[model samples]
Target: MPGERLTQQERQRIATGLAGGLSYAEIARRLDRPTSTISREIGRNGGPRGYRPQQAHQATVQRARRETPASARAAGAPLGAAGEEIVELAVRTGLPRMTARVHVDLLLSEDGRRTAAELTRRLRVSPASVSVAVNYLVQYGYARRERDPRRRRDVYVVDDDALYHSVMLSTRHTLESARAAMAAAEASGADSPVGRRLAKSGAFLERVSLEMMESADRWRALLA
Candidate 1:
């Protein structure tokens, strides 16, 4: 309902339309779909000389399969834990899965640095996706942005100090939030199984966070 699907018949019509010197808008109007939709479909499937209905249909099917629900995909080949986490985080943050994937790739790079345009070119994705990915990384403390005087756009870096700083900040915030949650649970006499589990997690988080802060301080001093 969002966009009229281009079927084999439509593909043939597209070929015929081209021979008749019909514009994309004219073809779209006849096909009852948006001009942009038709443009993208044709552009991706083969564009002008290479367009083939069966090939386009197969490509569409494959793309759909890749994006289908995990359950609907092959059994026992479930998305691994990291993949699942990325999907969940993308959903919660309203970011696309591809953005998370690109950011993660940049973060895991040996140099931990890349310019926005460089990332777009490397990933072969739209500039919008690159922008969203970089923003998400900055938001989560996994990456930091720095502008080069010579460059028009910002460069994202995954420096050790920046990463440590982000982790420490996030860990501290999590500890504080968990403490508050623990207090609320106790005040409500929620010491049942769920409450007890949550309280234990809070204590663990507080202790771990303090240790991490100490480690970060030591590392910073050593760097200095």
Candidate 2:
């Protein structure tokens, strides 16, 4: 199992562990979490030179709050208070708290992209969490993984093309599926309101799909 969240006792243990000159792996073994997790938790909040449990916890809360939704971001609330408020809003809005945070963080980024290391530093989260967020955003079409030509690692990027390409592809798939369903319904002679509605929907889907496809192709050609 993943480790339980660090409590005050655990925080004290971490400080003691460090003072005792135990390696991160040793500390993690005692804490029942991955070494990388411990390393990131410490690295983000403060290093061995100056790690304070209360301060680390507060810093994590602040990082979480900074990535909350736009409305919350605009409120200029205190970190701890804002994080709690955002969680309440997340429950009401059906937003997966961490997922929303990741998306909002990406949206707020000036360059629309950040490396995993950069995110780890910013969010005070484990690298695993950062990886999960990046993957979620990429899979949901809200972000894209772009290979850095000069480097081995890929960065998650949000861009107009990411949204446009996702929408266009989805539209094309919907059009094709609609066409197939329409043909089958027509052949079955089940010309009820449902069938008629299906046909009409297919027509609309096809028309919009074609327009989007043509526009996308033109844009691609221009860029090429």
Candidate 3:
């Protein structure tokens, strides 16, 4: 069931269900499929508002035709040992293989700027697959989109500052959550273990936030 492709009729039903204001779970239940399957189907085709059953089916067909066998592609253009090692390390660090591959490819690019089409060609993956990988990178701060001056297409950029920005963003959220947790724990009972734990956690998070800022500044100076 995991790899089963959605039929055109199923996609039609999904479109109809969306038009009727049905939730993804409800649609999935009606289709006797997983909610994630329904969600992914809609997401990849077009989000709820833009989904068109016939167009989606056609797109899927085109994508299937365009996708080359991974093994064959690998044999044709194998990555260097260093690149493969980086991809493996990224996978070990919790990234999905495709996402990690895309990230590492961007990181290894000399200019740190690559078009989606270039990424698709270099990675030997379908355009749709590359789009997903690029979206993941953008969402996680591992990459960014910039308009190419010479072309209408956007360029995906991976640079040193991306990691710094990601860290700072995470640090802000952690500090905010820790403060909220401390407040909640105090409301329950400041003398309790929960309160003490929250207090310590918040203090640690505060220190981490400060250290992160200092490190970012030092890195900026070095870069400058």
Top candidate by lDDT? 3
- In model 3, the Cα lDDT at residue 18 comes to 70
- Tens-place lDDT per residue, model 1, 38-112, is 789879988866777667766765675477777533321233456546654543332335555565556556797
lDDT of 2 by residue, 77-124 (tens): 322454546544633333344554565566567898888887767666
CA-RMSD of model 2: 19.0
Worst 10 residues of 2 by lDDT: 1-10
**Candidate 2 C-alpha error for residue 169, in Å:** 2.8
Q: What overall lDDT, based on C-alpha atoms, would model 1 receive against the true structure?
A: 0.63
Model 3 lDDT tens row, 109-184: 8988889998888888789777877886786577899997789898999887888766665566555545655564
Q: List the residue pairs that clash in candidate 2.
A: none
The lDDT values for all models are: 0.63, 0.63, 0.72
Model 3 reaches what TM-score against the true structure?
A: 0.59
Candidate 1 wrong stretches, greater than 4 Å: 1-100, 104-112, 190-198, 220-224
lDDT of 3: 0.72
